[model samples]
Target: MYWSLITGMALAGAVTALPRLDSRQGNGQVKYAGVNIAGFDFGCATNGNCNITAAYPPLQSLGGPDGAGQMQHFARDDGMNMLGGTLDQTNTGKYDQLVQACLATGAYCVIDIHNYARWDNQIIGQGGPSNEQFVSLWTQLASKYASQQKIVFGIMNEPHDVPDINKWADTVQAVVTAIRGVAKSQMILIPGNDWTSAQQFPTKSGPALLKVKNPDGSTDGLIFDVHKYLDSDNSGTHTECVTDNISSAFSPLADWLRANKRQAINSETGGGNTASCQKYLCQQIQFLNQNSDVYLGYIGWSAGAFDPRTYELSEVPSRNGNSWTDSSLVKACLARKAS
Candidate 1:
């Protein structure tokens, strides 16, 4: 669900306050629908360093010609309700415009920390950055967006290869405490290790991560963040898809979620624009919509700063004059609601 070269992400900080908002409180067929708006998180890598020099220019810089219009098209035109953006620790303030744009479009904003459980290639807490430092990063951010009801804190993106999964959970526990200390009602999405792989979640990381609780000792606004792709090896790089991942991934994960009385979100899942992707991706999302009881919703891999024609799994809409045309995959699947 991510490029190896430009990985890792988090969101900018804002002090503005608004009313509390929680969109996934009731039983339904997935409460939120959205796409990821990349670019602000362009220069990050699994090593935990974000080179601002390698990042893409701000979408706002493109002005109405297409920058802000991209988000508007997805929200107003595509009926998407949530918008995900990357936030890197080195450039937390870089995403303010992206966040503001998402808010203006009347969509929920998921500020994701795109780091893969490490900083400078050292595993977080286990040996790399101290847990306090991680908590501190969240604390400052939580305080800044405490009043922004539409803000959703994506604790970390795709954690993997941690030596002690239990310790990682403890680190997440601390981050949750720090965030809840400042923002009480905003939703927080927590990702498990192994790239938050849905296939490995129920067994590998779920047990420990499930132990993580809100300060109230409840799992109210906290949701599990999972990712699944349809490529042969599930790396998300190939242009063709080999499976829908229902039996191999989502189905088993769904069963576990229901059995545990918890819910999860498919934070990232997509395939290239092809007939194979069309058939399988549609089925995958349909499964999510059907099992909305334990699933919040799904967000496609991306659609920001990436060109529609050039990007492999492009969900970015193309513009012709004043009209916009969504990618074939989006039109046929991601943007389509349950029947």
Candidate 2:
């Protein structure tokens, strides 16, 4: 039933371009809008195509003892897994490499700090270092890349299974404060709790806005990072998922941003690219081009992943020969001009 709805919506908006927001007419505040593509999660790094096998094959299969052995091989070959490495925010070398790659492609790079510290992997918010750890990480990241016009700092990925919104807000505040200390001008992307749901932003109880005292005492560059997926519970989606959501699905977050006087961007959205999905994905590009105000920018789910079923774009296939590139997806993402 839902699929039919999505199909209808997709067909209805096929002829017309997505809506647009007049950014230039505003208060000279150029919104930092772009895609949120993850290249590294802890220690796993994806090459430009976002495939794990292209860069590190051992960690590709997270199996049992063999998986452990493969992980060791991966660590030896590709440095260390991000979870085990020193949480040194100042280490910008790896980040610099990722940023350079994205910029070279003429796309915005969104770095993800996939932190989870709890008994169940389900506890997305349970585990992770203290507030100080995030502070250090952001301080280093912001200080190093703060000046770059294209770089946007996504504080954290998804926070799930965590009940306390206040605590999450506090943690986000600490990181925001720390990042502000160094990257005053750079835009800070903040996502809501429970995996950054559009519905949660309005109903969730937390510090609604992250306030920072700039030297000039004016609110400068702060952005709301929102991740949306049409799948069940909004877990995540690929290009097709975004396409289906464009017609009737885009209104919730769009309305929120308008009411809050805030700018919103999909820091992450992409999983399993198929033919229909590819067309759906291209529709999002058209959507972004038309709607510049509510939809600031976006980032694809990954630059690398073990499962080919979940990839939106990749340089090589995890299962076998070189699939190399999804020309359709790439073409769609790069087609729109930064408005």
Candidate 3:
């Protein structure tokens, strides 16, 4: 009976595999696991194809009244307290709500852990917690949402200040193993080092598949994650620069995947919501659409950030005023269907 139930589910899941958006055949439409994917970020909190940006829920400040330093850096009592409370409160109901919201918006909910204590220093050459801590966190998160179908897990936001590829591979394996234990079907995204830069994807000598030993001494289910930023040097605002950078970095990885028969996804990209970077963002979407095989999908850098002072996306202040959502870049991304 147990085997029969498992078999039934496997068959059902197979039947609903993510669909491909084929532009050559008809109007651009997105298919996910054999079905059309409604593409929108749940975090955006916008309804339908609306143009208004909604404010993020008021999260208690990790930093004191001033909001001076990085909230994820200090690990202060208040911050940790808030973190625990938010996770406890949201992980269950909030996750479900977010997932439903995205589905309603015609998109899948790509849940990002966002911060892993390593990001603070990596942006400036500072180091973060030991790899063990990261593994433990992954294990816990994987276990929490092991059974959800709509959730795609992004392992880490950006791995910066970490140059050791071997260490990165090991960490990836650990997290994948831990998550697979509970949620075998949930797509796991493994980013390359240095903010998921395509430039850093293992070209000549790096672990191809992150593997871990199962109880029967076998391994399965891993997906490579790559992020493409048009300007690696972080200079210039030209759309061509973005497209060129994406073409240069992504072409190699795309080729590698085809040659090796591996799956990969462009999990995240998009700079701040500024007029200067709008064209760059659209060009990126167009490029990804052109090469969906190499670039499976994308999740923009953010719908919103906890820290309004530094990571603000909408033009209006998150605390006081309403923000506009229908930016040119975001519209391009949402309107983009698999092509």
Candidate 4:
């Protein structure tokens, strides 16, 4: 469900009124087919500014039978998560551009901080920012977007290599508190340590992530963020998808979340454009669809400024100037909805 923007209204400290959109609405959760906006995930090596507009049209078209919907906009990994630095103007402008594009298109935008597992090659708990520094960064972000409800905050892309599992959970709780202290009502997506994969949930920090609490004394607004891939190792790196791994690995995660009465979203999952991948994607979505009470959504790996079709995660998107041509990837995302 998408929401239109509100205009022609000015009340003292009143938020612009748009129809509230909720992706997790009971068992009838809207199946959102969204893409990840890339470029900024490359960290400091690439240009800091993002051409978010160039990626929106293609994402808008991926909305299934429904109209234009949500897409996760990745921010530059500029060591802010590690160093707890002030918000840089260039990246702020890019985030604004992304929000503006989504606002214009009557779509929801997810602000994804693109730091994966480490900062500058150092893992999170081992030698990077202390719990307080990480909390401070999230606090700044929460304050910056305190008023926007359509915007969802993904705490950290994928935290890994924490010396102590409890420390990771404690750090996440602190960040959640820091955000809530700013009085921001935005939904928060919480990922487990160690790449936050479904495969890691039973054995790794995923269990610890359940201990996170909001300042409201509840876990009401938090969503579990997970990723899955069809490759043999269940990592997104390879193109060869094992035939039964989808059921083998993800089914247990579904069972666990359902048992706990918690909600989750596979915010990242993709495979190659091969015929087998098509089958894999459809089967994966079908599994999530059947378990809709616990699984809120599934988003493809990516497409953006620097992301090319060569990246299997991009679903082999072919660029025509600034625009992109569709592939079988979009069809796979649309399959379960049509069923």
Per TM-score, the best of the predicted structures is 1
Q: Candidate 2 on 1-117: residue-level lDDT in tens? A: 000000000000010122244433233212332222222342321111122232221122322112222222222322211111113343344334444544444333444454421
Model 2, backbone clash pairs (residues 3+ apart or across chains), number = 18
Q: How far in Å is the alpha carbon of 72 misplaced in model 2?
A: 31
Of the two candidates 2 and 3, the one with more favorable lDDT, higher being better, is 2
lDDT tens readout by residue for model 3, 69-185: 111211121111011001354433533443433333323345454442243334211244556666666676667667656556666544544556566666667677677777776
The global Cα lDDT (0 to 1) of model 3 is 0.40
**Cα lDDT tens digits for candidate 1, 1-339:** 575323222121121232133333334346677778777667778777767676663375643224467777777777777777733653556556667777888778888777788878998898898999888888988887888888888888888888899999999999999999999988888889899999999999999998899888988878899999999989888779999999998999988887788888888888998999999998998888887777778888778777676778877778787777888888888774321
Ten-residue stretch with the least lDDT total in model 4: 2-11
Ranking by lDDT: 1, 4, 2, 3
Candidate 4, residues 1-339: lDDT per residue as tens digits? 000011000000111221233333235432344555443343231112223332222223332111111221111110000000025676465445545554444334566665553455555555765677777777877787787665666776655555677877777788888888875566677878666777787568667878888776777768788877788776676765665345566788867775665677777777766677778787777777666666666666654432353565553345444343445755555322221
TM-score, one value per model: 0.89, 0.63, 0.60, 0.74
Candidate 1 weakest ten by summed lDDT:
10-19
Task: State how far residue 294 of model 3 sits from its true place (Å).
Answer: 3.0
- The reply for model 4, stretches above 4 Å from the true place, is 1-31, 44-86, 307-309, 316-324, 334-339
Q: CA shift at 20, candidate 4, in angstroms?
A: 18
Candidate number achieving the greatest lDDT relative to the actual structure: 1
> Residue 35 error for model 4, in Å?
1.2
Error of 4 at 175 (Å): 0.6
Clashes of 3: 13
In candidate 1, stretches whose alpha carbon ends up further than 4 angstroms from where it belongs are 4-28, 62-65, 86-93, 337-339
What is the model-wide C-alpha lDDT for candidate 4? Answer: 0.53
Model 2 residue 291 lDDT score: 54
TM-score pick, better of 1 and 3: 1
